[model samples]
Target: MKTNPVIETLLSHRSIRKFKDQPLTEEQIQLLVESAQAASTSSFTQSYSIIGVDDPEIKKQLRIISANNQFYVEHNGFFFVFVADQYRNQLIGRDHHEDTSVLDTTQRLIVALGDASFAAQNMAVAAESIGLGICYIGSILNDINKTSELLQLPDHVYPLFGMAVGYPDQDPEKKPRLPHDVVYHRNHYNPQPSRDALDAYDQAVRRYYETRTGGTREETWTGQIARGLGNPYRKALKPFLEKQHLGLR
Candidate 1:
């Protein structure tokens, strides 16, 4: 397959859960943020904020909030929480005596989420390009209220996700992804995916887990999805958003 430097960097992506004891230089952090800022935003809203966590106590609290298993949250060279933010925009609107009710709409919330996700991906790619490793921590939502209070996030600002970046202490193998035919379609959507392709990909994922875990754990992609969706997780997410004065519509 043809590959360029950017493509190679993307294909080599792995979630680094372990990191060396070194911390990132201020210059590196600035570059990462600049890369994230360069990401496209909806209607130029730029509805996002990046919070860098450097306080040890705060990191410890966040580690606990993240289930206390992901030590990388506290041990990484740098940690960032990408926030879906419209609070700043709302403040601007208030100062201009304009109605800010639109900021609370679901459409605005989705826009902010998309903006944050795009920025996070840009930062992830930039980190990889600079020979650094990164991992996204979605468990930050496990205790949404606590996370919000911990970060002192205001209304119209939600902690979308957290990322840990650092020099890698381990190099794990890349997990297999869904086959192209299963995900890609022509001009129209494909209601029926290729079962054969899905089965092959499941087997590949099972093999990956087995190899990575020394044959002790073998799970397929479908199985993982089933387990994840079998029970409702973060049932308070909607209420939390409502409390934050977002996603009302």
Candidate 2:
């Protein structure tokens, strides 16, 4: 396969759950944020804000809010909460005496979400390139209201997710992904995917888990997806977003 240094880094990406006890230097933090800022934003709105959690007490609280399962939240070099924020733009519009009703629309919310995600991915790649390991903590959304309150977030701002970056203490095997044929289509959408390819991919994923867990886990990708979707989680997300004055339109 055609590759370069950047492609190698991207391909070798792994979630580093175990990080060394060392905290990140301020210089490293600045570089990571600069990389995030370099990501493309929608119409240059830059409708996102990154909150670096340095307070030990706050990290403990966040670990609790993450269902108390992800201890790495409080033990990383640094933690960041990427927020989908339109509050800044709202203030801008208010200062100019212009209508900011558009900021509350679902369209603007999507734009903010995309901007935040792009920024986070850029930071992740940059961190990896600098010999740091990172893991995305989406469980921060488990209790969005409590997270918002804990972080003291304001109206028109929502905490999308958290990220923990630090020096690696352990190396884990890369998780298997869906096959190319199942995800990539030529032109039109391929509603009917090849079952043979899917079956092979499922077995590969099952073996990956089995080997990773020493046979304790042997579930396939399809089974995992089915279990995840069997019951809807976070039903309060929509109401919570509306309460934040986002996606109200």
- Rate residue 33 of model 2 by lDDT: 97
Please estimate how well model 1 matches the true structure, expressed as its whole-model Cα lDDT: 0.95
Least accurate stretch of 10 residues (summed lDDT) in model 2? 62-71
lDDT of each residue in 55-117, candidate 2, tens digit only: 999999999989777889999999999999999999999999999999999999999999999
| TM-score against native, each model | 0.98, 0.98
Residue 64 of model 1 has an lDDT of: 95
TM-score of candidate 1 on Cα atoms, chains taken together: 0.98
Over 4 Å off, model 1: none
lDDT tens digits, residues 201-242, model 1? 999999999999999998899899999898898988999999
- In model 2, residue pairs whose N, Cα or C atoms come closer than 3 Å (at least 3 residues apart or on different chains), thus clashing, are none
State model 2's lDDT: 0.94
